[model samples]
Target: MKIALDAMGGDFAPQAAVDGAVLAAQQLAGKARIVLIGQEDAVRPLLEKHGAAAAELELVPASQIIEMGEHPAKAYQQKQDSSIAVGYRMLHTGEVEAFCSAGNTGAMLVGAMFSVKPVPGVMRPAIANFVPKLHGGLGILLDVGANAECKPEMLEQFGELGSLYAQYVLGIDKPKVGLMNLGEEEGKGTSITQAAHQLLKVNPHIHFIGNIEGRDLFNDKADVIVCDGYTGNVMLKMAESIYDIMADKKMQDPFFDKFNYEAVGGSPILGINDNAIIGHGVSTPLAICNMLLQGYQMAHSGISDQIKNTFKS
Candidate 1:
């Protein structure tokens, strides 16, 4: 398998991208290859400086760069030669099995929607983040910043999407799906959650559990949590802040350490035609390394194909 990396997309740019590629090359040796996309002059030297042999990595030249602050649609259209745009072109044409970037999240989302498109039966594609459970395990949470305003049907679809991800990628069998709500009762949340609960309860594709409260996020009550993008995004940021605050206090608990974003590398854009992993803008070398590995895992595991089949039926 071949995974493409946007060498100029992140704050650290070519240096961190190159270093991470080298680390991933050593770890994924003989199993997969890393393709770096950026200005050749800037990327090649970094590869050499990082002691990555030419045989280990392939460089794709891109002339321009889409800055982090640029508009997603405009930058993608105007800068066709930018690293992010070129990376999407490669993914569209099947030049690589997966594409990863820590660059503009909006551009990545736009590119995935227009370039590769969504699965046939999927109403809307969802983005998912891994929730670190308290019992030394992980749960899947969906629609975390994509489609902030969702209908009840969209939330129902997210349950199926999250369930497939938990099953295929995380190796969870018969993952229990739960809707995030203020209370655990049947009619707890707003009109949307109440309607979504009815839809989820009747869906055969997912093992629908009752509503899961905020305190249950860290426990093993549910393996897949579905919520609107607005709520899910807030929950994700709040969880992230816990880690930041703990780190500031110099706390070193094993459970809290799992909250670090670097451990998961990046979150994959699920329900798309191909693998498109999005990393944090401030991703470090370790984070980028994990991002590349996650991209490779997504491709090799054939999660996209499995999702497509499920949706088609």
Candidate 2:
């Protein structure tokens, strides 16, 4: 298998990306290879700096770049030769098994929609993030920033998508799916959550644990938390802020340390037909390495096929 990375996508650009890819290449030496898509002039030099360690990695030239602040749809359409665009084309053509990028979150999401597209039954692809469980593992949170406002059916699909990811990629068995709401009762939130709760309850694909409050986020209550992108994004940012505060104050714990974004590397765009991940703009070499490893795991676990099979039925 092959994993592709946008060497020009992040704040640190080719240096961090090249360093990360080299690390991932070493770890995935026998299993898979790394493919870097970016401007040859900028990326090739970095790869050369690593000597023989980066020799095995392939570089695909891309002359343009989609800036972080540019409009996602417009930039993606106009910058066809950009690193992100080229990476998506490679993924769509089966030239690579997975594509990962730390630059332009909106561009990554847009590429997922227009390039490889979403699974047939999916209403909209969701950006799913990892949540550290206080007990011992990680949980999945969907619509982290994909669709700010989602229909009831879309929320229902997020549940199914997150559940499948947990089962296949995270190695969770019969993952408990929960709707993120103001309360745990059957009647809670607005019309959207109520309707979604009803749909999830009757849906045979997931193990719906009903509504979950924000307080239950780090608990073992649910392995998959489903919500509209607005709510999920707010919560995610809040969690990150708390981690930053703790870090600044020199307070640390095993569970609290898990809140660092570097630990998870990037968020996976679920419901897309192909494997793609969007990483934080400030990702370090370690974070980039972990993101590529995650891309590999997503492709290898066959999560996309599992989702297609589930929704097809």
Candidate 3:
């Protein structure tokens, strides 16, 4: 299998991306090959710097680049030869099993929709983030920054999407799904949440655990927390801030360390027909490496197929 990465997408691009791809290549040696997509002139020199160590890495030239500040839809449409665009084409053509980029998040989502498209029955594809569990392991949070406003049905689908990821990729069995609300009670949220709760409770696809409060984020109360992008994005940023604060204070706690973005690498765009992950803009080599590994896991787990099958019925 082949895994693709946008070599020029992140702030530390070409160098950090090259270094990360090499690290992932070393770990995934004999298992999968890493494909780097970027401008030839910019990326080749760095790969050459690795000597024979980089010989195994494949470089695909893409002259154009989608800048971070450019409008996602406009940039993606105009920059057809951009690294992100080229990577998506490769993924769509089955040349690569999965694609990872720390570039523009909006562009990644645009590529997913325009290229591989969403699952047959999926209303919308969601951006999923990992949550550190209090007891052990990680939980799934959906719609992190995808659709800031979602309908009741969309929230219901987010639950199913998050459940499939938790079960297939995270290796959790019968993952408990929960609606992130103000209270644990079923009728404690907005009209949308109340309606979504009813829809989720009867959905046989997941083990619905009722509504969950913000404090339950790290607890066993829910393995898959469902919410609109507006709420989930806030939680994700808050966790990131906490991690940064702890690092500044030199706290060094194991649980808090899990909050580091480098640990998970990137956020997977779920409910799409193919696997695609969006990484942080300022990704370091370590973060990029983990993101590639995550792509490999998503591809190997056949999570996309699982989602298609579930939604089809």
lDDT (Cα atoms) of all candidates against the true structure: 0.91, 0.95, 0.95
Q: Which stretches of candidate 3 lie over 4 Å from their true place?
A: none
Model 3 local distance difference test score: 0.95
Q: How do the residues 208-278 of candidate 3 rate in per-residue lDDT, one tens digit apiece?
A: 99999999999999999999999999999999999999999999989989999999899999999999999
Candidate 1: residue pairs that collide: none
In angstroms, the error of model 1 at 66 is 1.0
TM-score of 1: 0.98
Clashes by residue pair, model 3: none
Off by over 4 Å in 1: 52-54
Tens-place lDDT per residue, model 2, 1-313, is 9999999989998899999999999999989999999999999888999999988899999999999999999999999999999999999999999999999999999999999999998999999999999998999999998999999999999999999999999999999999999988999999999999999999999999999999999999999999999999999999999999999999999999999998989999999999999999999999999999999999999999999999897
lDDT at 39 for candidate 3?
89
**TM-scores of all predicted structures:** 0.98, 0.99, 0.99
Q: Model 1, 189-226: lDDT tens per residue?
A: 99999999999999999999989998988899899999
